[model samples]
Target: MEYCSLIQLKTTMMNNFLTLFIAAFVFISCAKEKDPIIGNPGLAAQGEWSIPLNRILDGGPGKDGIPALDEPIFVSPQEATYLDDDELVIGHSSAQESKAYSHLVMNWHEIANDWFGQEPVAVIYCPLTGTATGWHRKLNNQVTTFGVSGLLYNANVIPYDRNTDSNWSQLTLECVNGELIGTRPEMVNLLETSWSTWKTFFPDTEVLSTETGFDRSYGVYPYGSYRTSEGLIFQVKDSDDRLHPKERVHSIISGDYVKAYRFSNFPETAAGIILDNVEGQNVVVIGSQTQNFIVSFFEKQINDEVLTFSLPSDDLYTNGNFTSSVILTDQFGNNWNAFGYAVTGPNEGDQLTPTMGIMGYWFPWTSFYTTVDIYGEQ
Candidate 1:
């Protein structure tokens, strides 16, 4: 029965490879919106692009001719009467027309550098964990910050721009006034761990830790895609050591629907497969029809690591159909197994409808275990 599925899967795979590629091309080029600001052309949506905080502080001389520097200014409660409640304001910069997030901006020092570009990224900052930052779409190479689930606990700063709100809307620090507030030191430390791994993405940028008792740090650089090109930036950080293991794990393409589990059965340490902790891992997913799927992994290093699997073309196909049952195992014998199929051309009665399958899972971890399952058939 497994061999039969392999035969049918192969037949379907070879016949459909060309059709699959052409269909994927048409769908990606013509179907999606591609930009988030098209429908809602607001300030933050239009004027504000995402950026790292370090770049905002020392991102070279802005149009206003001010060198980016870490200048945390304090204001007396008396000198300026509190007009807006539940908000902290940083001194206004005379250079740009708008004021950036002060508490959020002053929150951290710099991100750690590891792989060239493999950090978890997001656009919001969490005041509790102090790990919210964004890079401009134009400048970020369509990349993003990671480790947001851990940082969401302390999200207090809300950025509003003309696109989303009034252009001059006061940037405010709003929180549930009486809720439990965590320490800045711990949050700063977490931010350092997150960003330190991502410093490779920004070659020119330098990570600087806090001099004061606060755990805040800054990335110093002059020419970032954010400062001159867009306007502002927020630094992204690294993941926690516990949730993210020192070793990286990945999946196989035909291994789709095949879930990975840790052999250790450690409380929160289950991943696809474990490799050498000292060396990183490299894993790729290849589909029956080329270009039908993509494989990527996060929370693990994707450096020059060895992969020990191969898909034998002949073993996967029979009678114009390719069918196979593949099993992947950890060194300890725990395994994730699944079935796959392929074809050389469309079957006589099979309709050539293109399937748009965006295959990726979001595991929102917050010092806890969470899973985001995607249900689809295409």
Candidate 2:
């Protein structure tokens, strides 16, 4: 009896120790920033998300509509020019003539500065580890330097400098993950200098294919030290300010975190979904014609049961297309939902007529449920 008691006591102590260790790991590492609104990549039934036929966000150094800047990075087109628009200039990097999509420099820069605004982010996307990282790159006429800001996901920021390089003679990075990879000027020559050229930088990275509806695993940020893969690692407007999936140049426009979509004019086949107990849900609330859809959650799936609700079309949209305010909540009690309308179908004499349609602008057709915190995760 004495020996059995001793064994039991040891087992109990061991179990307690393990429980404490696990608790500490979760407490120390599983820290999530308190974000109210989460982006859900609403996946459709066909296992495809709807990708706009046209690319909404424009890139490159020089372009119309956008104002010019002091940066030297420019498109390699016959008439290379300075970039004016912030969005178009977001990804512009002075890489080797071969590697137009060289992100190694950009990732180093972005990783240094957690925030990416109008300035350029030197990017490096490694598909093997699914790591998409960047750096804030700056170059003068003769010299160049790379800054490293260790701001990672779900952790306190770490500021560190890796190296200082002045002679950036040939801008290209070498990638070898159990194999070999490098971008040569010849590869750039073969590409038509389109976005595909940029994608070549991440041969193994996953990007949202124009042909596919599925969004690349763009927002997946892991804890500790891990590499990023090639995904939608490019710069984009803040979630609130992002353009509709279909609006090409307009979607990439940078500025205020504007509310661009509503739910009033949701298609007849569309269904409204409500998530209960959403702790950290950043979902892109999409109303589509079929039940097929995908929404990414901080957790593989939301813990709470989802409820479906319907608001009359008449109350939602003046025409036939509309977006509802996104709702994020911690519990079912406080639901934050808003709405935006799309100018797709014919709504004769509607104020949001095609003639008045601005690609990325949102006009209020129906009042949002402001009573709830749209940014709060339920």
On lDDT, the candidate that comes out on top is 2
lDDT string for model 1 (241-304, tens) is 3322212112111212322222222212211222221113233322322111122221111134
* Residue-level lDDT tens digits of model 2 in 54-131: 211222221211111113232343222221111111122221112232222222222212212444434333221122
Tell me the spans in candidate 1 whose CA falls farther than 4 Å from its real position: 1-124, 137-156, 162-205, 208-378
Off by over 4 Å in 2: 1-13, 21-121, 124-136, 139-144, 151-253, 258-378
Which 10 successive residues of model 1 have the least lDDT summed?
Answer: 180-189
State the C-alpha lDDT per candidate.
0.24, 0.25
lDDT of 1 at 248: 16
After best superposition, candidate 1 residue 312: deviation in angstroms? 26
